[model samples]
Target: MNIIQKTDDELLEIAIPMWDDLIKYSNKGQYGKFIRNFSYNLLLGLNEVEVGKQFAKSELTRSLSPDYDVLGFIRRGEHVSCLFRVRSTKKEGEWLGRMVLGYEKGEVKIFAASVF
Candidate 1:
């Protein structure tokens, strides 16, 4: 199925769990699980050592709250960008998290994921 063509509810059904897993794995510093759904290019830009460094240095990343609000969704070309209101378990406020989804090898995958 083309993820970009999916309904908002359908897309959320797929994305939310992946987002949850990303948070879960990140909190545990599990690089492999955190990036398991990432696309090939996305994974190419990251490595275990670099991710470990991030897990060690970024308190916010390490303390991400699993519960997040879906801010919105944007569809462009073959991708769907999921915006989220993310919070840190140890911090006071929220951050914007973006997870861009697209097809890779005929399977759904995260093209990019970031928080700011």
Candidate 2:
């Protein structure tokens, strides 16, 4: 599912079912492991983003770490995309965007991602 533009509620609805399905078929290796890991990590990242947004709204200025629970790596084109949630209080408080980390040639890269 494309989660970039969807609200948290929408994402949760889609994600939970996918996660459950992954768990149901987890006995298979490789593919099963990948699905489970991806679903788990994605959920964790979403939660972190939500919490971070709340903290930002409360005007908490502490450095917020990306939620690792839902954070994960995926191969995209020639690079690996590190998918995670990002928060910026200055814009509007709470979570701001989806962070994507990719490799450019041989160097690390970051692409501000949006789901549509």
Candidate 3:
């Protein structure tokens, strides 16, 4: 993997568009804010990828109940790849989703995501 290191400003620039999209489509309202904050925290490296991985692994043993979870992403070149694993304690159904975002060479992209 070609790991791309980004400054905080650069990460924000990349994240805003995605955040806007989530706001427009998400029905959670203020709960969506939590997702946005989580995304920013991840991009700022306040939440490490390792922690995300751990959450992914331990999700099966925990309860979900519409709560937020840490998501993980890797920046490669001009694209960002995200991993989201959804776990529901109330049921046996679990799902994992992955998304990729690409931007123009000099442009920025933003996103909000939740995972377990």
Candidate 4:
């Protein structure tokens, strides 16, 4: 279930919807929904309270738009990193978004995700 082996279209099929959910949940400050697709290890590494605080304070995370453009994908080991050009609904700038996908328990899951 290595996502790196998936074709661009196949990868987009899986990644885009997840990315959409990420942006949607982040904007709403819904920590649980934001991490719904995260891998077990990623979930374990996150501090829910810290994330909630950040969500409440970070202007960027709370203002993401539903629209985005897929920049491309990068492969590393069993993981595939998807890049997006994301714009803020409440601000006048764009940001680079990254979502790393890989297999966990034979299912595709997010290993890491961030807006930088």
- Highest lDDT: which candidate? 4
Per-residue alpha-carbon lDDT of candidate 2 for residues 1-116, written as tens digits (9 for 90 to 100): 23344455544454444433332332222232323334333444555555345434533223332221344445445433333444432333344323343333433333333311
What TM-score fits each model? 0.94, 0.26, 0.34, 0.96
Which 10-residue span in candidate 3 carries the lowest summed lDDT? 23-32
lDDT of 4 by residue, 49-92 (tens): 99999999998899998888999999989899999999998888
The residue ranges of model 3 lying beyond 4 angstroms of the native Cα positions read 1-3, 7-66, 87-92, 109-116
The best candidate in terms of TM-score: 4
Worst 10 residues of 2 by lDDT: 23-32
Stretches of candidate 2 exceeding 4 Å from the true structure: 1-68, 85-97, 113-116
Cα-based lDDT for every prediction: 0.91, 0.37, 0.46, 0.93
lDDT winner, 1 or 2: 1
Candidate 1 lDDT, 13-69, residue by residue in tens: 989998999899889988878899999998888776877999889998899998899
- What RMSD, rounded to one decimal, does every model reach? 1.1, 14.3, 12.6, 0.8
Give the alpha carbon lDDT tens digit for every residue of 32-98 in model 3: 3433434343467545455445444653423443342325666776567655555565557655534
TM-score, cand. 2: 0.26
Q: What overall lDDT, based on C-alpha atoms, would model 1 receive against the true structure?
A: 0.91
Count backbone overlaps in model 1: 0
lDDT of 1 at 109: 97
Worst 10 residues of 4 by lDDT: 1-10
lDDT for position 103 in model 4: 90
